[model samples]
Target chain A: MTNRRKFLRNLLSVTVALGLSKKLFPNLIAFDDYFDDDEFIIRNGWVLLKSDLDSTNDY
Target chain B: MIIDLDTATKNVKTADYDVCICGAGAAGITLAVYLARAGKKVALLEAGGFEYSDQSYDCYKGKNTGMEYWGLDTCRLRYLGGTTNHWSGRCKPLDEVDFMERDFFELPGWPIQKSDLANYEAEAKSVVDISGDFTAADISNWTSGKFIPDRYAISAPTRFGDKYRAEIEVSGNISLFINANLIDVRLNKELSSVTELVVMDYGKKRFTFTGKNIVIALGAIENARMLLNCDTQLKGGIGNQSDFVGRCFMEHYNINYGFFSGNPKYWKNMKKGLSLYTDSQFSLEHKIGNGNVSMSISPDPPTGGGRSKELRKYIRNNVCKWDEITELSRKFVDFQCPGDGILGTLMEQSPNKNSRVSLDKETDSFGLRRVNLSWQMNELDKRTIRTIGIELAKEFARQDYGRVQLASYILDENAKIPVGYHCHSIGTTRMSKSPEYGVVDKDCKVFGIDNLYIGGSSVFSTGGGTNPTFTIVELALRLAKHLS
Candidate 1:
């Protein structure tokens, strides 16, 4: 996987793995480079899955 | 009485005094007030007039080729009040750990201890117009091992000009000269003591003032420029013996590390550590670094309208719903916090030899070489910030306060480090026990020059993360007593 994608996957995994850790996402999205991206948007506790993905949530 | 050098008819003249102080800023004024009260004659030479003039401030303009910084002329004010005219008034004493020599930092120790300056600090609080009470109730056990109880006191940030103008006018012993810019320090043939201070005002009118003793109370950058420019008797500068005059420039590397929020109970525990006069502080036991790092948290909930208000209320009111918590987290997900608080870090840097101020060929209108400041950070600095941040993040998670998201820039080695000088310039003329290690000796006197001494943050051996004004006043008060 690409570095950006790999980074996003790891970030999402860490966010979930830590049981909705609040600090991680705030700091991650604080960066202007990733602030505009919509893939991480969450609605009703479910993250909007990024495109170009298979059914399984595996990197 | 305040004499305007610009208007004085007897411009080309010589005067004698017991003490000659350069730079009518915090240190100079503090020392003058104390010494004058003790019935000593003092000659206080201020470069600028009572108010700031463009021509006077232009002298501070310089070049910066090292780290990004505020223009040299911008950070410090060059008037009667000095930089205190624009000070933020945050006050905190240096921790005990800051005065000790740590193996992790180079030249990381002071010749004196906190106790040595304790009495002076008590007096300094009155000078800075802050409440003397600096006590804090520890709540570290609330998070078990997550935080240490650290606190800070606020200052009125006494402006020396407005606050002491009446006292200076009434003091019969102090000859306050406005616009009397110090141009040269003529030493005796042996170069042992400063014999005269050659000052010039606008219109090229010159005046000579001699004193039994001389104290350079100019701020860090100007102090180095003045010393480096005094190359008539000495090759490099006065007190440049051992080549330590302008080395080891230090400043607090302040940055927004990350943001985090705690549950209502967690917030309550944290709130107990903060007050109007004193605010939150943290320290780590068994730390690997030489300097103690202090971090402060600000509650920056969303602004604008009822949406932000509702969002905050929902996050504070609903703790159990995973969906609401995720939505609450998303608000702050992209640098925009829709949450309870924000976290910032103000870290101390180990003294680095390469970080220094040097003379450039470029001269200001006064023909004095402008100071070229080289501000560089070391690996220890980066490592300390990252390590402390990660440790804090882990502790919060373990204690269920909330997760900490460190700024991506802090984690990225190649990311352009954000640039913002806290206006706390320090350590150019660092103090030490011997000449080999520093520019000034134990009593704040220059190494080889007998009667020449230094006052201000320039004499700091280590630039602790705490704001420097409080310590500057404390040291100035101490130096006044020593001189008397």
Candidate 2:
């Protein structure tokens, strides 16, 4: 559980940084590393699956 | 005249007072003064002396069965001024929406509307030493559409014992008795009215007084304790035939919910403790209770700002891998953030039947039962706090004002909520249109009991997000007029 959380937290930071910087630097980075999977995304702080995020639109 | 129960018991005549009020705190003193000015003879009783003492405060000791809470003896003051002796003096009246019934909440709303108490605002302000308009347009303009400014008027925080001591001493119609604890209440044969009030001092010296009307102005917990302890006449307690005397106990849910990184320019000009509340429409749309967030600007911004602090808190509380922590730290170094501020919240807790005050088996020095406070919160309350954080974060992001990083407990539904209270005990003797719903009526009179009234936050139908002193004074003023 601990390792899984760490992996998720690192993924969240990278994803959030990419998402935020995407508007300013659209082509600065390629989306191939982790964006291949469309199921997982970060909203606010939680790492949610697309279906779960849609159901619990907390924000 | 102020009389010490120790030496002056001989001078106190036990007959024919127009009004007898228990607990010479804010409500008791307020009611006494107003009724005295209206030409009514009043007997005002104080369980404690002019100052603090261990003997007096020991009565407040009680058990907490449901939730972790501040020690009851320490949360409230027992002296003549009551808890106002140590209050921070933040004052705001309940909002209009606080009185209306909402589909999301289960309890019955206030019997009286905000407009009904508007007539006493001026007098209440005078009593608390607050002047000028409570809300500022400039503060309201700073917020986006989702939130609006909510102002709290600072008071000299009038100590009723000190502020009204001279007036009470000079009043010919008002008799102030210090160290007089109300131990027992005797009702008529029909149990329709309180016939006599039996008071005792620390020495166990007893005295009895009779009045045409009686007002129980003890603070919230004590008021309920008093009613529940007077079981000699009524089985369940006086005016408790419906078993509503000590139910629906409430307190303003105070906690630090999130952190904000606000715009430096806007933050510099704003007051350090300015509050912003969720707009009424937003609250209704979100199906959440009313909420207020007070900003406390950090004197020195942390190395990584509010987000870093939030992440650090989360990491400290939850199990996280070292590699993920290092990556999160590296991301923070890459992203420069503005100054951070802490967001302290005061959210309204929905009234729950289980949150209540009951009589404990253990007796105090005077043989009166101690309060057993079971402070409970439901799913609605938890949701309200979480929704307020989410809404605030979204609003800040929308306006470019800042970003809000919510506390970890707010993000996880299964996490235990940190227990916090504002010491604003309320709703134990709630008012309603009828006895089937509450202990008191619209006039603060006990249901089914004539000439017996309640004054203070105990009669509050709902504990809004704001402090209760202003409303307590307003209700006392309204009750005084009704009694007169």
Candidate 3:
């Protein structure tokens, strides 16, 4: 637990941690709660969990 | 690795190097370390720096030594670590499914399989520090039924250059540079052999690096872009017959953001398992019917879904409002998704000749033409993504374990759209059995060109719907051992 926490702290600075953290924490993480109200998707990469799975930009 | 006067000359330096490599990113550096460890002279030429030495390939990724040059979510770095510097380090091996030639799709499987690259993967594990024993049979045995307890897991993703930085630096035969950038590759009059590698510094100081053997470790787009730029002697570009040089460009396609509710606590699974499996690749085992696929699963919520049921209840009942009930329920939904986070792919397009990178009139920091990326998704790719999306939703629904929802397609074109760009791409200089079909041969040697080799994801013949780092490192190590 101690080691995992340290790893998480390091990972949070980068975006990969968002997905990785959710994977590690499962139900414990709420994306809405992690950041402040000022936070928007522009400065942050969205967790695209339900909106874009069907659309594609291949062309 | 000095920016001496002869550098602008390309491939005819006075230094004594047993091997001279171009593009000092992941594969080039790995090969450099191997040659050095084996007591051979090695000189590496990089087009960028330890991430910031040259501004051309910077992806705005702040330095984390080993991860300094990790490939970013939407950009490529022409810097020291190659693309691995910015990579998410989510390593997984290419499986038998990824290796099988999909007759259903116009693709050819690799001559080797999960078994062929095992030893290299072992070495890769060491190169990038991570835990977990990656074995093919272990993954194969996962679904064998009664005797097998579903211990199905995957590969450990580790950043290669960061993991092996110290080893590369201390080696006796390896030499690395921070500011070196490949400008032009001077070839012989025959236009078949690479005689000199012309490099330039941020100061415009030209350098020409020469060696008996040379390698191109530049990433997929840059590899082809560089070749196409070297049109001084070769018409139609070097090794560009059949217009194959910039053809068949591909990448893994991943479109996320679909919802899946009704799983009660399915959110928990996606979060906890992100770090659970450390195999070579992630696939659903039976994803081929929809046209060659690989997968990973995760909960819809962030920070993992372990306490999802509890958190959802707290947010819904205790936090505040009856009006926000729908929003809270949306949070409780059990949708799961995984992607190459930075260049997170939800789909991988088949090799198409049209999707390519070509030179535009606009120049970059080094006065080179800005590489104009022409990425096009054919109907085949769109059809596959939609088909696979429905199929996967069905599987998640069929499991009786979770509900898979598809909504984005239900909206109008101008509605919330999802752009599935996995930028973890391959091809441009593909490998095939012969020169007629590829840029490199079985050993990653560019066809007809003796001593010129290409490693990294750039040489990939097909883009299986999975991250290519594990496979890239494995191939680098294979080249290392082969050259060692």
Candidate 4:
């Protein structure tokens, strides 16, 4: 029962990550490719890119 | 020198002036200063005193028949400084395309070009207390070709009554008359020129002053009311030969049409109070009127204890672990975030003859008929608002800069568009090249009457998307130069 639960948990995490990637970046192809380039990072289950975190002080 | 017509000696009536300007508003005050500097004797008549009085303000009371609107007495002030006392002081020149004749519009374009008024930019800025340059560079990184950054110069809102009172009081050429209401406009025997203006005081004391030239500088609504009320000589009124006097009333249509969720970087970089205007090319291509969009940042609102129903249901059905639920809550909180900004729109109302001011049977203390305003909007005006929303939404999505969720009313064709006015009354006695189309000529002179002229937003040929006060001062300066 413990092993089965671990497998299910991993499957759910991957499914949620893929769903979020598709919704946030529709133009992007393949979640692994974007992850490899470190274009997007998941924090608290929300996708946060470098551009989003950078401060835009110039007005 | 300043003279209180109510207490002034009767001999003051015998004085004839070079110019008799009605209504001591921005236009009238500017005209008086410039014309006096040119060494012309002037009589500047203000219906109200230096300050507000209920008796004087009561003259502005009227009826509104079409569309929801603020009361006539509420929309405008009747005192010496005029509406400038309560103006926002946002100044921007009319766009060049606003002066061009678009084939799609029903009305004729302005007879004068934007260049004609460009010469008075400095003087206008001085009169309104706008310092530094009037132009601002576009956003360096904005890639959207459909929208461009528009700048507005905030003025100190120089109140004409307060700022220029001392100047007019001490000037030898300008005779500032307080509490002098224009009651009649007597014409020459040939009915080709204005001979004299009959003014009345609060106590119904009447006085007449004759001038070589006469100008009605009352605000748009009152200007029309005065013209339509002076029907003693002509059946319709003075300068109403074309029957276009009091027609085509316009106001800036202001409303909130959508909400924007901008990308964090661009949204944070946007200057507070920034305004985006539809590109002139976009307007021409879309066959729509000019529009201005402004965004205000707002805090995001949370619903259902900070988690959406969908997220709560997903977590419950998935039987997610404690750590997973915490992460999902934070993600869902960000995902269902409220709009980052509320998009407000201000657009020009296309000129329509039915949107007008006419005289009502009800009479004021002076025994003159009151005004009955019927403000209307057409399909083009409605379409302009909807198109701005749709186009902005599309552009924001395409550029990946933001997302726009339009108001349901804008998407529905049959839904009534909730609109409000900017209190910028314009275009009752429009300027046209020919008398058949409009009441005033390019020089702002009444077509058949050589000496009668008008100075105010009432003479606007096309009410552009920007505020009208700056243009009013510019036109007054031009008229002063012409008269001098």
Q: Which candidate wins on TM-score?
A: 2
lDDT of 4 at B4: 88
What are the Cα lDDT values of the candidates? 0.73, 0.81, 0.56, 0.81
Candidate 1 C-alpha lDDT tens digits along A1-59: 89999999999986785555444444333333432454333222122233313344221
lDDT of 2 at B261: 59
Candidate 2 local Cα displacement, residue A57, angstroms: 26
lDDT of 4 by residue, B1-484 (tens): 9888888877785357999999999899999999999999999999999888888989999999988888999888887888888888889989899999977776897999999999998999999999887654455677788988877788887888898998898999999899999998998899899988999888888899899999999899999899899888888988888888999999999876645667777676565634788888998898888988886565433336543666655644443335444333433342323434567777988888889999999999999999999999999888888788767766665566665655545656676888888999999999999988788999999889989999999999888778899999999999999999
Clashing pairs counted in every model: 1, 0, 70, 0
lDDT per residue as tens, model 2, B1-484: 9888877755568679999999988899999999999999999989899898999999999999978888999989999889889988888888898888886787788888999999999999999998986963365446586788876688987887889999999999999998899999899999998899999988888899899999998899999999999999899898898889999998888876646656655667776555788788888888888888887565433345464777554543442335344334433342222334667778898888899999999999888889899999999998898778766766665554555655546666776778688888999999998888799999999998898999999998888888899999999999999989
Off by over 4 Å in 3: A1-59, B1-14, B58-74, B107-114, B135-161, B265-345, B408-417
Name the better of 1 and 2 by DockQ.
2
* Model 3 C-alpha lDDT per residue in residues B1-484, reported as the tens digit of each score: 4333223444434366777777766677777876787777878776664544435544222221211122332367666676676676655666555566665455454556667788776677666665576423223313312111112223334445565567756765666655667777778877668888777766677766787777778778777877777777877666666566766777665555354433434333343221111122222333332222233343234333474756554653544344233323434453222221111123556766677766667666665655656666665665555555544444443433244334434122223334455558687787776666667777888776777778778788776655677677778888877776
How should the candidates be ordered by DockQ, best one leading? Answer: 2, 1, 4, 3
What is candidate 2's DockQ?
0.06
Model 3 has an lDDT value of: 0.56
Query: Candidate 3 at B211: error in angstroms?
Result: 0.9
Rank by TM-score, highest first.
Answer: 2, 4, 1, 3
Give lDDT: candidate 1, residue B123: 88
- Of candidates 3 and 1, the better by TM-score: 1
Alpha-carbon shift of residue B214 in model 2 (angstroms): 0.2
Worst lDDT 10-window in candidate 1 chain B: B273-282
